[model samples]
Target: MPGAVEESNRRLLRARDAMDRRFAEPLDVPTLARIAHVSEAHFIRTFRAAFGETPHRYLQRRRVERAMFLLRCTERSVTEICMDVGFSSLGTFSRVFRDVVGEPPSAHRRRGPLPPVPTCFAMAWARPATDRAVPEKRPERLRP
Candidate 1:
């Protein structure tokens, strides 16, 4: 059972690595499923179970991460950055950017270039909050 689990994880990692490397490409579940050597439905289910997000959501987050970096580090126009990050429509790109980063691309870019920190540190610091688990909501106390 452990070995089977390991093998399944390995397959998922291969597909995820491909997504990480080719984030700007038009990736779909079929291609990712082929990479994982699983049926599309299984791939989607297992991917969500293993990674805590759907493959499409993962890909969108990856793209938005890259766009966040580009927005902070480059002077490229928002439209160019949007297209370069694999989004077909500027409106969609802006919407997703806002959803992921909590702000539009131009607004994020207005913060100016990243400080002169190590690339690894910069990336880690600039990473969006989507990867973290959301805290459970608590009920409010009654007021007097």
Candidate 2:
């Protein structure tokens, strides 16, 4: 690969790493673009090309991944987990969780105990498989 392309990828990776570390924070395209030293539109396009997902979607996935760990390992309530994982609304969290994990958080939490293995291996094994289909739109019910 050319040096320019390689350097661009490195910059993208740095932004991605920031997203991974600060997934709980409100990370917008402009912030990420600044981190990558690119225009917002270019950052979105190049990030999608390099990562196979948009930066927003990538951040959502990271948040959901952390929520999965909290759901399985901690006795925290689902709403608490949702808020702790950076989702402001429980409805959105449940919807995104169901879309990404193929089940509601409660169902997922009850599925099984974590296997007796290394934490890294267990996390990898438990991470939700990505579904490329358009997430189904559902009516949101009010929650207290």
Candidate 3:
């Protein structure tokens, strides 16, 4: 049983590694499933089980992380960074960037370049907080 679990984890890691390498490319569940050698549904379920997020969300976070680094380190326009990070639309890029980083890309950029700290420390400090689940919006009650 432990061996089976390890094998499953290895497969998931392989798919996730592909995602990390090709984040700038248009990737989909079918391609990832093929990489994992699993059905699409099973891959999604097990990925979430292992990583605590869907593969799509994981990829979005990865792209946003790269965008964050670029925003801090380079003077490229937000739209350019958006396209470079594989987001096709500026609007979508802004929205997702905001969602992941808790600020718009321009605002994040205004913070200026990363401090002269170790790269690992800088990345650890700036990584988006994805473990906390976003709360669902509740309907407001009508007053009598």
Candidate 4:
């Protein structure tokens, strides 16, 4: 039974790796499930069990992570950064970024990049808490 559980976790990791590698692509439960060789329902359940967050949330978090880097390091517009990070709509991107990071993209960008440090340390420090509730929608300010 432990071995079976380990195998299930491995499969889930494979699917999650695909998400990490292709975070900008359109990904869905069905596709991820097939990658894990499990049913959609089972994939969702097992993925949550293994990873502590749903696949969609995981992907969104990944996208936001990338966007955070881009926002802090580049002079790109918020819309460009949003689309670059795989969010199709500016409003949706702003909303999700707010939910995950506790502030809108513009605000985060204004704060500037994290101090020079090891990439691993920066990423770990910047990663959002997955269990935090998505905040209520607010009027997004897209200005730099």
Candidate 5:
């Protein structure tokens, strides 16, 4: 309905694409703002207005999500998966994974087919037929 809004969304999508390319690099507000052709202040506000979270937090969550997938699907070590997902430190990755997935990565693995998690991530790992029904927006990047 809003044609002008399409341009802003395109800008946001461009910003999101750029973010995907340079995710491992430091993604500061000014950098993302420059990519979006918006002022840093406005970029922060606008991105959040459209996506529902701050830039940095979104990035961290994406990394964590990728790590979760790797943990579940691959035989890679936690440290390898941590670095593969752009986490530089084992301690930090473990803490963040625990925070988001709500359990230790090893414990989650040890749980076997039963899976290790609280209701949130467990709900995610569950294979409900309605999986296609959810609409997940790209999360913003993590802060330094």
Candidate 6:
């Protein structure tokens, strides 16, 4: 990558990191773009190029990941966990959970398990995932 593009990516990553930290609340593309000092289209494009997914999708996935952890590590109710992890709609939460984690939240809770894909393989397995298949937890080549 060229120097300018690398710098822009650094800015986008800054925005992404900020949103990740604050994902348990509302996040808008405009706000994220502003944080990155880029226009919305540019931000979205850069984000996808740099991270391989849309911002909204990434946020939802992160929320679901957090919810899975909390579900296994805590005794929180489904509804409580839904809102606590920033999912505004329980219906949507359940669907996304099933879509990405391969089970309904209740079933996952009952099973006393969470999404098994480790961060090492998070990129290959997260986001556009299945509701029934247990994703192979393969580690990706390490990055700096």
Clashing pairs in 6: 102-131
Q: Which candidate, 3 or 4, has the higher TM-score?
A: 3
- Give Cα-based local distance difference scores for all models: 0.88, 0.87, 0.91, 0.89, 0.70, 0.77
TM-score, every prediction: 0.88, 0.88, 0.89, 0.88, 0.68, 0.76
lDDT of 2 by residue, 20-134 (tens): 9999888888999999999998999999899988888888888999998888888999999999888899999998888888789999889666878999999898877655442
- Which ranges in model 1 have alpha carbons more than 4 Å from their true place? 131-144
Q: Which is the winner by TM-score between candidate 2 and candidate 5? A: 2
Ranking by lDDT: 3, 4, 1, 2, 6, 5
Mark the regions of model 2 whose C-alpha exceeds 4 Å error after superposition: 134-144
The weakest ten consecutive residues by lDDT in model 2 span 130-139
lDDT of 1 by residue, 1-144 (tens): 469899999999999999999999999999999999999999999998999888888888889999999998888898998889898999888887888788888889999998898989988998887664323224498999
Off by more than 4 A, model 4: 135-144
Instruction: Say which candidate scores most in lDDT.
Output: 3
TM-score of 6: 0.76
List candidate 6 stretches off by more than 4 Å: 113-144
lDDT of 6 by residue, 1-144 (tens): 569978897898899898779989888889999999999989988787888777876777788878877777689898999999887889878987887787898887786643566754743543344233323324498999
TM-score, candidate number 2: 0.88
Q: Which one wins by lDDT: 4 or 5?
A: 4
- lDDT tens digits, residue span 62-104, model 5: 6776666667667889999888877789987787677666677
The worst-scoring run of ten residues by lDDT in candidate 1 lies at 130-139
Instruction: Please give the RMSD of candidate 5 to the true structure.
Output: 8.3
Model 1 C-alpha RMSD to native: 8.1
lDDT measured at residue 23 in model 1 versus the true structure, 0 to 100: 94
Please give the range of 10 consecutive residues that has the lowest summed lDDT in model 6: 128-137
> Candidate 3: where is the Cα deviation over 4 Å?
132-144
